[model samples]
Target: MLCQDSAFRLYLDRCRRHKFGLTEAQLPDGTHNEQDARDWICAACSIESRAELDHNLEAWQTFRAIRNRFNRWRARGGA
Candidate 1:
């Protein structure tokens, strides 16, 4: 179970309406921030069928881990 926040729900709807993917750039709605995007994608991912959710979860986790690691590195000293 994940946090069912308003932002998450909004993104879920966005995903349902459009083709949601791992967007590298800032989403037009300003979902570029890591946590914000995660909230959006996670919600989006969870809204699909169980099979789809299961498949997408791994990819989402990988993406999030990589992004978080990068974020940490930047916080430390990385460019």
Candidate 2:
């Protein structure tokens, strides 16, 4: 299930402060394309894009940790 609107709103707000603010790109309709959707949501939530990230970087390897940080921040009302 998707996140609730209230939770999403809070996450969106937090994203504005924390994420790269990437814009959503519209794809063809009915495409089971989850990446675009995921990117859209992450953009909305201000979460960093892991798509083009170079996981070779030491900091990049900490991707999950970054996600956890955002999740924790969301739980804490990251405003």
What local distance difference test score does each model get?
0.47, 0.47
Model 1: residue 40 alpha-carbon error in angstroms:
22
- By TM-score, the best candidate is 1
Q: Determine the C-alpha RMSD for candidate 2 after optimal superposition of all C-alphas.
A: 9.3
10, model 1: CA deviation in Å? 32
Which ten contiguous residues of candidate 1 have the minimum total lDDT?
Answer: 1-10
CA shift of 14, model 1, Å: 35
Per-residue CA lDDT of model 2 for 50-72, tens digit only, reads: 44344435434454455565578
Lowest summed lDDT across 10 adjacent residues in model 2 is found at 24-33
List TM-scores for all candidates, in order. 0.31, 0.28
- Supply the TM-score for candidate 1: 0.31
Q: Write the per-residue lDDT of candidate 1 for residues 18-42, one digit (tens) a residue.
A: 5655343434443335455555454
Query: What CA RMSD would you report for each candidate?
Result: 9.5, 9.3
